[model samples]
Target: MIKTSGLSYAALAQAVNRLGYLAGKTLNYSKSAVSRWIAGEQPRNPVPELLLEVFRKKLGREFTYRDLGFDIAEADIEIRSLWYSDLSTTLDVAPLMWSHDVFRRDLLKSSAVAVGAMTAPARNFLPFEPDRCRSRTGSIPVSLGDVKMIREVAHQYWRWDSKYGGGRFREQLVYFLHSHVAPLLGGRYGEKVGCGLFSAAGEATMFAGWMAYDMASLGLAQRYYTQALRMAQAAGDRQLGGEILTCMAYVANSAGAPDDAIQLCEYALDITKGRVPPRVQSYIYSVLSRCLASAPSSPRNRPAALTALNAAERHFARPLDGSENAWVAGIDFRGLQTQAAHVLSELGMTGRAHEAISVALDGRDESHRRAVAFCKLYLGMVHVKEDDAEAAVAAGDEVLNLLPGLETARVQQGLARLQREINSLGDTDPIRTFNERARTLGDRS
Candidate 1:
């Protein structure tokens, strides 16, 4: 297994020791010790567990003692409970997941992304019915002010994620959710306060999911999204529920499940029809546009994508009467353009795609560095498709400049795609310079 993973014995030993230190134990395991373990000599307590984690991280999947040919009893690992029958059950299960996310993040990060797990939440939430009473009778008392604080903090986290990228503040947000907000969920609160608290908690949880998605931890993101949907259902916030489903759809599309993504977007649009504000409707339609565009290209797909995009634009032009949910309030016209750019690009409308991407880039400020980087990447790819090497190189250069400050895997992946596009443009001086600079920056990263 170690040979198959391409890890040297010394590297494996170092990884084990580092994991041990992180778990608050200090031990020196030499390469020879690793060799002995490989030769069928069992290591004592905690070593086996650490080895499993090391393999899990390396392989991007869960591992067991049996899989490693270790002659030991397989430890019963706790599978995260995602679905719940009632509000109380959800409250109990969600904190456990958050706690694991905070303390056992390695396991969560390497967990497989289960596309099927998404169905239950959407199935339960689309009915638009509120859960049973959310009022709790724990020792601590929760107030509307507390709920307000959670919402504010969640908004702040969103700003940080947009600016610094998810790798920077994801752990802090999960810790905040697990340590501060989990207790509040179990505290004493009236019906009104309970609804507000659940809504606030749902927003925070969804943000956590967004951060996970940003960091390329798709499995962890899915779990957080599922729980957020559950909380939204309990809060009876159909708008928020729809928004969460849209997020799930985005992640689903990114994970190569366009069918699931389209279904989720359809659910969001169906459930929130006539209930949400224009901006919220625009957000849903925009996501639907992207999902439809991602499907196998066909005569109907392009028209369907354009229709969704048009619906998004029409709804976005309507005047805001101050009733928009905070969750969808940030989906401004520029945000809609970003999604439009993607749909157009997928539909092979390079000229329109370039125009839409430029609009998105023009509207964003410095605080949205990650978003700007993504827009630039899209612009570069569109330039590539247009056979304009100079323009593409220019946009790629801008993305390169932004790469050093950002810590997002999505941006890295985007840069890789940009590199591939530039590589396709022959061996020109500008292309050579761009690739060299990209290589240097990537090495530094």
Candidate 2:
């Protein structure tokens, strides 16, 4: 028989801390336990998996139990893909996805692509009959039957994010749903009721992912997106599947994976083909523009982005049917224009970018502080690029004031870029005032 060497607990803890740096998050660990582990102590169940995470992150390699000084074990279990009828299992998965974003940042960034590799070949999961399942008790839960209520709450939270930015209420919302709302999902109900519950869970999970993404927990965001995708697939919600895909594409693009983002956007478009509402289609196209804007600025690529913007505009111009959900339908020409503005700004087309930003600002409401802040940020950058220091400082001050409350890393990147521009001028002029304010804003953020 071959003997496997175990890691000392202290060595294990040292390894985890090293891995945390690579994964871009802090790991709470001590040397003594790691020493214990190396002394042939089993490190505990979750600890082993966390060890795997550490090695995988730092070494760019996957780990088996053997790598952690344990006897080779069978592959760790994937979270079971339970149907809505499986209330206990579904509940198990919901909190797993919900709480993951609180700490796991690496999971949010690249895991979507990691999952993509697993999912791309099979496109869908093993089929399960929706008819065979029943709720825990014989009765359906009230929460399951009332999906609109959950959607309304989600919209309200989305609006809150738009106003106060994501930092204001994201954690509060997650805690409420995870603590109070999630229990009801595990209650007894028929298949009909169970499906509704799963659908709500899916929506909530998607938003949780979005909140994490906004907060720059890229790894956690990706994990939540993957969970949301699985839940949507189980619920047979094509619309949601598309929405999640678009969101994933946004994250990919944000992370500098333009090609991957474009592919995901195309996948979203193809899945919806003919069935998606025009407004939803426009929303998807807007995200496509975001991805394509990151593409190399060749004559061809620029036209491709313009084409997508035009397609989005066409969809926005269409009349909505009653079946079109209001939140989805509310995405119109102005929203497309807003997206186009940002894309133009990113591409350094300052003239066109300014035009689009002005139009977007005119149409956006005062309560949309996130949007307002972003537009000002863009305008400030444009002014700096145009060598208008006074104009840049004025617009940047507006961005600086609101920047403290926004949790999005993209927002911080914008501020950083602006500071660099001001610093490049090396002027002790009032223009440098923007840099100081931005530094203060950075500290708060």
Candidate 3:
């Protein structure tokens, strides 16, 4: 297994220790401990659990004690696939996914391919028939206070992800969800409590998904999002359900499936039934417009894009009534304009795109390095579109400066894209210099 991951035992031990630290454990793991395990002694208590995560993340699948040469009993979950019709099965699986994901970092090694993963999950999202409840009641009596705690924790994590990149906080967030929240599922609760529990857990799952998305692990994000969708449906949280679908739409858009993106957004709108707050509605419309504009110009859904964009603008123009869903707390004017800028640029509205993006860029929080990088890249693209070589070079340079400490694949890809655009402006000194640096953006070492 070490050979497969191309890691020495020392390196693997180090990885395990780092992940454990993120889980708030204070332990020093020596290479000899791993050697002792190889000599037929299983790691004591939490070490084995941590080791399992280390290897599971090293390889993108579950592992056993035997697989890693540790003499320990195997703990497995009966539920695995998201295709299961029973929401209870999904609830059972959420913790399983969270356990693996908490310390699992291998998924970030590549951009997960998005093909048909969401189809099964989204089908389940469409106003489905409720299944017989199968929650196994535990000793702890669930309460609204517990639900509120989960909601608060999930909201706090969202703010963290918005400020720091997901790569910075996903491990800690997943650790809380898996270690703290998952155990609650086994404790006894009535249907009402179950709904609240699932709803809160679903938000945690969505946060996990969003973090993966921020890291550019589209495929892993899909798995988490799929579970989130099922959990929300079981809880009958319609607003959250729509938010999950919209998240899927964002993934689809990034994965080069613009038409699929548009379809998913429409499905979300259908389920929302105008029940979402006006701010949330505007967010939904803004994303839909971005998708429509992303399609190839020949068959681009411009008419639909225009309608969606207009709706977004109209809704955004309304004052905040403090009635918006908590899940969409950051979906304000700047976020709307970010999508609008992209749509307008795609529609050949260069001047308006430039103005919109400039404002979006100016309004971005410096703590949100990932988003700041994206705005800079898009701003560079707008300059390229307007045939301003000097301006494009300047925007590209600033964005390049921001990329050194960021570890996100989508951001790197955007930089590569900006480089390509720069290349088309002829091989001048600024273009050539920017192009070379951009090529190194994907250098992992």
- Pick the TM-score winner: 1
TM per candidate comes to: 0.81, 0.74, 0.77
Model 1 alpha-carbon drift over 4 Å, by segment? 1-78
Write candidate 2's Cα lDDT for 222-329 as tens digits: 556666676666566667778888887876776666777888888888877687787788888888887787786556777788788878888878878766654576
Off by over 4 Å in 3: 1-81, 103-114, 128-136, 297-300, 436-445
lDDT of 1 by residue, 373-413 (tens): 88888888888888889999999999999987788998998
Between candidates 2 and 3, name the one with more favorable lDDT. 3
Please list the C-alpha lDDT of all candidates, in the order they appear. Answer: 0.83, 0.65, 0.73
Q: Candidate 3 at residue 6, lDDT?
A: 78
Over 4 Å off in model 2, which ranges? 1-91, 99-140, 143-146, 297-299, 404-407, 425-428
Q: Could you tell me how far off, in angstroms, the CA of residue 3 lies in candidate 2 after the best superposition?
A: 21
Name the 10 consecutive residues with the lowest summed lDDT in model 1. Answer: 76-85
Superposed by TM-score, candidate 3 places the C-alpha of residue 218 at a distance from the truth, in angstroms, of 1.4
